[model samples]
Target: MHIHENRPGVLTALNQIFAEQGVNIAAQYLQTSARMGYVVIDIEADGDVAEKALLAMKAIPGTIRARLLY
Candidate 1:
């Protein structure tokens, strides 16, 4: 996910979504600047669960984009 606004709670929201969907986060990377934030989350989950989590993540405020890579 790429967050357009660098504010609090965005990462928490994303993590919550993953937790709710029963997705296991294997690893995560995050970088933030004054204007934007970038996150790469490595997860272990079924296809449907991953898709659900991605959808939930996209709904979070300030999320510019979210997609499943590989």
Candidate 2:
């Protein structure tokens, strides 16, 4: 996901949604440029939960993009 600058609680909100959906985050990485924040998360979930989590992440206010790579 790519987030807008100075957006507090974005990561927390994403994590909350994942937890609410019962998705387990196995690993994560975060990077930021002058104007954008990037996050890559590896998660584990049964059936459609991963897709659900991606949908939830996409719904976040500052998310620029959220998609499954594999």
Best by lDDT: 1
TM-score, structure 2 vs. true: 0.83
Off by over 4 Å in 1: none
- List candidate 2 stretches off by more than 4 Å: 1-6
**Residue-level lDDT tens digits of model 2 in 9-52:** 88898789888877788988898776678787888776488777
Q: Write the per-residue lDDT of candidate 1 for residues 1-70, one digit (tens) a residue.
A: 4454788899899889888877789999999998889899999888888788878888899889888888
How much is the lDDT of residue 55 in candidate 2? 81
Candidate 2 clashes: the total is 0
Worst window of 10 by summed lDDT in candidate 2? 1-10
What TM-score should be assigned to candidate 1? 0.90
> Each model's C-alpha lDDT?
0.83, 0.77
- TM-score, every prediction: 0.90, 0.83
